[model samples]
Target: MSFFSKLFGGDKEAEKTALDLFKGLFGENAKKDDKPEDKPEETAQEDNTSAPADTGADTVSSGPSGDSWGDDMPAEDNQYRHEGAFWLYFEGIFDIEFAEYRYEKQVLTPFKRIVYTFYSGETKVLAVELMSERCSAYKFRNDCKKAGLAYTRFYIDHSGWWNTRSYVVRRMKEALN
Candidate 1:
């Protein structure tokens, strides 16, 4: 099998192994099917689950638009909900020393937004932002370029679900080198 196929699970057995890994990490949240037979249904489910939660009236809102970090936000605000999957899939491929979340304050806007920085030893090798459906990653990409930093956006299932881990690993390796 091609390396891509092996990395991404070319056959049923390989696919089953990958699914098992995901299930071990995410439990019931990990999908069981190896095929895209129900992509539309999965997409709908993802859309509902991936959105930021409503804070209601009692709590102050915080995000790009709100005053506080917002409710149910990840420790790394820029981190996509599925980043743990990415880490689980790719950590074996790279010797990542550490990952950190950073905030960039917009001069024009009142919000301070988070972005991810990955380090290999002391060198900052990559910056990543996880974008939701309504958000675009262009600005983050541009910022990375201007700062001479390697960067990429991690979108949920940008490729097919089964292929995304391998695709992201390829992209990160390319960027790191």
Candidate 2:
């Protein structure tokens, strides 16, 4: 099962539930009744034709170098940048207190990593670790569970970032209220 399926539910079920939730939150137009078969199929010749060329003049680039969508950096380098961005995004959305806690692993050389814990007033509500890769997310989730904390891992990828942000914001609002 996918991480989302594990986090939410089964694939189709989670998608349907999310769709229903969005429809309810955004109103009726969010729900689509149209199916693919409703549209007329194009001939094989039409399918073979090349798609329209991009003019490129209207394209907006917002990445570090204004040439990509910000995923070109090495995963390790991007992790800290993504984590800071995630912090700013949440801080802007909600009125809450954030504390940074370090977990130190003892080896020949002690390894210390920072994790962000968010509080709704006096109650520690959520612990978040922003990871550059999906594998790290699973490890972080396990670590948080072992620590007996409410945890959510946000990945640096666009979809993962947005999905996690939405889920965390909803949960944080509920916890605060």
Candidate 3:
């Protein structure tokens, strides 16, 4: 469905001209010297420019950011599961924070289902997994259909995640007073 393949790459002269046409059509905001091929090659193993995610793959890796993980996670309408996005939404949108409780491995179930128990003091909010990827969070939040996960970078040992737990405790203490 994308004509981008035909438009860019190979024949540097043609690519430059095509890019210029696009720049003129889209906007004049782009700087004059900014040509993709003009830049020095990066030393990194991976290409710096993004290649589109392969839709054919069963689970396109969320990679460093937590978007999808195997069959355990729901693939559609799952944006609230990302660690940064989930926490940011609560804090930025509602000024609310939920205290998290992580279990010590294999204690909860035999299946490799990973999740956390969310709470406000003694009251439990819900049990869910934080997944990565961008999807319609609205469906999960408002609709009858259930979903977990959102576009964000998160892992069990991510230090920022542990720090975020403190936000809820502080909120709880403030509420008590």
Candidate 4:
């Protein structure tokens, strides 16, 4: 079902039931404000002034650069798929890009889904919609479990998810080769 349909489908009862189950199992409050206000917010800031500057300008960092949509660096696990094609993993803000594919509408699906298609001059890539916010990670994991597709985590709150698809296209050389 489409996201809008699921959202406005008047199935609040089921959603509530699921939320209750999650709350019971993880002790996670369905609503953030439900937590006691006793925990004080930490205003601590780390002093990075002493940190050494990066000396390697030639090295490409693994995050979005310029206007490109995928990472310049292919994934470390190269044997699974896209032996030569560039790989980009999206996480956090990158998930926002996947929202485009969630709807059955005018926009094209994300390129990361079926990146192998690019190897043969096919630009189309399949995108699977994640139904639940709480389960998106699990859903994406399960989706990748069914073979022929590659999977990589974006690693939010850490380092990962490089964006630069245009670089991938250039590297692929479909326009010149």
Error of 3 at 18 (Å): 47
lDDT of 2 by residue, 21-140 (tens): 344334543224533222121110001123233222222224333111221221221221222233354444434422332222112111112255665556655665544332333565
Backbone clash pairs in model 4 (N, Cα, C under 3 Å; residues 3+ apart or in different chains), count: 5
Tens digit of per-residue lDDT, candidate 1, span 73-134: 32222212233444333343333322342223122211112355776567767875543333
Better of 1 and 4 by TM-score: 1
lDDT of 3 by residue, 121-174 (tens): 565444333322222223333321243312121222111122123333343344
Please report the TM-score between candidate 4 and the true structure.
0.21
Which ranges of candidate 3 are over 4 A from the true structure? 1-111, 130-177
RMSD of each: 17.1, 19.1, 19.2, 15.8
Per-prediction TM-score: 0.39, 0.33, 0.19, 0.21
Please write out the lDDT profile of model 4 over residues 129-177, one tens digit for every residue: 2122222345554664574433333211111222233332233233223
Better of 1 and 2 by TM-score: 1
Model 3 residue 6 CA deviation (Å) reads 51
Report how far off residue 120 is in candidate 4 (Å).
6.2
CA shift at 156, candidate 2, in angstroms?
2.5
The TM-score of predicted model 2 comes to 0.33
Candidate 2: list runs displaced more than 4 Å.
1-86, 96-114, 120-123, 158-166, 171-177
lDDT for model 1? 0.41
Candidate 3 weakest lDDT stretch, 10 residues? 39-48
